[model samples]
Target: MSFYHNRLLEQDYYPVVRFYYYKEWEGFNMPNHSHEAIEIMYCLSGSCLIEVDGTTHKLKKGQFIFIDGDVPHRLFVEPGKSCRMSNIEFHFEELETVFPSFRHLVSEHEALRMLTESPKSYLLFHDSSDVFQCLNALILELDRKEDESVFTEQLLLGQLFIRMAELAAKQQNDTSEQHVYIQKSIEYMHQNYDRDIRVKDVADAVHLHPGYLHRIFKKAMGTSVNGYLINHRITKAKELLKRTNITITEIPHYIGMNSQQYFSTIFRQQTGSTPKQYRRESRYTDSRTVRSEHFKQQAK
Candidate 1:
């Protein structure tokens, strides 16, 4: 799978499953958005951070994040780092006929219940070899293009769904305590990103030593504490730059960066555009002068 090719299902397919492989992707900023399809995102090489309903899920290699349909989510990448991940989107209704028990389990199991009921709910699994193999095989089959064997595709899809259900059933006992610590730290970052926070601050919040936290955060998150923090802040900065009339100079301050120069440099490094450049060319704004004046006067 290359950078921009999408292997989508045809209209007559039993189920619509799309395979996407993005290679060495520079932080592609996707805003809070939603679709009617459930999405399973697998980190293939470099790490990626995804925010679903404002809670950030940091996924390194071999980790999966299951997002329910109609969930608002966004993906983030570290500045100057290339992230490669697989996004597999499939509609739940497609499985109604094939996997009736799976849907029953989703409604019956508490863990799976939250995933379907709550828009903000998601399931995360780490270091699952079976899940990884299933996803990898699906990608390979889809990439072949000529191997349009509906039977083979259906078999693989059944296997993948079975693996996912098995994992969901046993996730309660399979979750790692260390991974929980990392999640806590990430949640702390998400909640307090606007403050003058540091890695030590996050470590302290999670009750881990700074050095030990750095090691685990990198292993779990595939980026340093500062790297995640900066990317998180940059994400917020991007939101402000587009949706608000706030001047570029004031945008960084709103997102906790004190220096506009540093903010612009980091913003450009992550997004390939300066704050002003981003603001000047956003669909969020049709005309800038009116909004800019309104924001500036409101700030005053």
Candidate 2:
């Protein structure tokens, strides 16, 4: 008996799933190695470290790293710490297939294009989407190897790629948005620092809720909104004291404070000097500079 099959045509793009596994490690280390397949290591619990090309990245719970093909890397779990992770390794090959390839998908999805075209050898991301579920499903299907499993596996893999790409893109967008909001808040503070402005006024200018603005501002600026405002006022007061012969009592009003005593207390706390003492010291330094210049001109 003889068997006959149709000839396979060349495909522009097709993904080949090499292998995948879920593993737990404790104080386990893998030496640097490279493979032809791209890989993803997703942490489910605890944490681990991934060293790639001399840079070490801490992969905590819910985070994952996507490493490109032929990139040398290794995983290390510290002593007394354990990490559970799901990993999938895959590569592309040219073959006949009905499914969409990553190249083709990139044309339709800007996020996917960025993911594939990024110059970084590896990308780390925190997963908040269905990426884990899809990856687990693909692993299960691959292990089954039952009839019709191939189609299901391909579909799940495609979903996984799209999900991861979207997650990375969302993270980038969120970071960019936060940066813009922070810059706007700082600009608002600088512009209105000489007024009796409250945190709510700054929030209102940025169209953000006061509490939300406070959280992000502190996170980005390392100080609260009110703290930044007070610091700015003190800075302006210092400049006025040093460069101008402004009255010590009027410095508070110039910097938006009505109570001279309160201003003095805060200034002392920040600069370790009372306003009067600072003014006196500044004048003494100026007189010394003038005398030195006169001596130099006389010598010439």
Best by lDDT: 2
Best by TM-score: 2
TM-score against truth, every candidate? 0.47, 0.75
lDDT of 2 by residue, 132-159 (tens): 8888888888888867534566678778
Error of 2 at 59 (Å): 3.9
lDDT of 1 by residue, 114-149 (tens): 433433356787746998888789878778858544
- Cα misplacement distance, residue 110 of candidate 2 (Å): 2.7
TM-score of structure candidate 2: 0.75
The 10-residue segment with the lowest total lDDT in model 1: 1-10
Candidate 2 residue pairs that clash: none
**Alpha carbon lDDT of residue 241, candidate 2?**
95
